[model samples]
Target: MADIIESAGVVLAYGVAGFAVMALGYLALDLVTPRRLSSLIWTERNVGAAIVMSGQMIGVGLVVAAAINASEFQRGLGVGLVSTLIYGLAGVIVMTLVFALVGILTPGRMGATVLEDRDGRPHPAAWVQGAMYIATAVMLTAALS
Candidate 1:
């Protein structure tokens, strides 16, 4: 039916928007760290890097989902897509800022610390930084709702 097709189109649009936001998140994370993120995870097999990236991706997803849900209810499809993109980018920015702030307050650089591994195991800082990303996303979700 025409309605079904239209619904599918909306879904596609939203999907693209979410993907764009996630891509930005990845790029933001890549910028903060010293080594190339892809190399760190894929080539080096860095557990710490993997954990940090996973946390960022998950956090971005949460914020994107919340933005989409809230925007869809309050506005139409177009506005929803735009808002989702905006909110998702905001989430990325906030997460990056938090990372930087923590880096400043902590004894060592947060990004470098999280990427460190010992005997193939991730550093404790990795877990803490990862949680920070998720926690920041949770706060953003609350703000969106």
Candidate 2:
């Protein structure tokens, strides 16, 4: 019980820190770009922001998991490698489901605003972000249990 509580606290701390870092990245980008450029790229910029946030969250989660699972986290290199692959595959599937569900439920323009490219193609960075999420999940699962 105490271990679970401690682990939760660590996860919460990591999550908050990750969010702060993501916000800083967005602020920096906004400050560096001209107003006109910012207006033009606002949508794509938000997408980038989302990707950055996702990476940060996963990175933080991995670190937190490592710290929390230090004693029982001995899965060896083989387990680590396998978990990475499995988590990555699961992450891709989960991401796809999110996209599909959003598309089905939301109205067109609003959906577009939430996330979309001018050309209607999905962003490449989504895949990269998904991999990070998956990798973190894999590491956490192996380490925690």
Q: What's the lDDT for all of these models?
A: 0.92, 0.44
Residue runs of model 1 more than 4 Å from their true location after superposition: 72-75
Clashing pairs in 2: none
Question: Residue 134 deviation, candidate 2, in Å?
Answer: 12
lDDT of 2 by residue, 1-145 (tens): 9999976875565445434433443343234323332453454565533553455346444543443344222565345434433443343344334444544665542223333444544455444444544465565456445
Which regions of candidate 2 fall more than 4 Å away from where they truly are?
1-75, 109-111, 116-145
Q: Write the per-residue lDDT of candidate 1 for residues 1-145, one digit (tens) a residue.
A: 9999988998899999999999999999999998999999999999999998999999999999998987753567878888889888999999999989989999888889999988999999899889999999999999998
lDDT, candidate 2, at 40: 38
lDDT: worst 10-residue window of model 1: 70-79
lDDT of 1 at 16: 97
TM values, all candidates: 0.95, 0.33
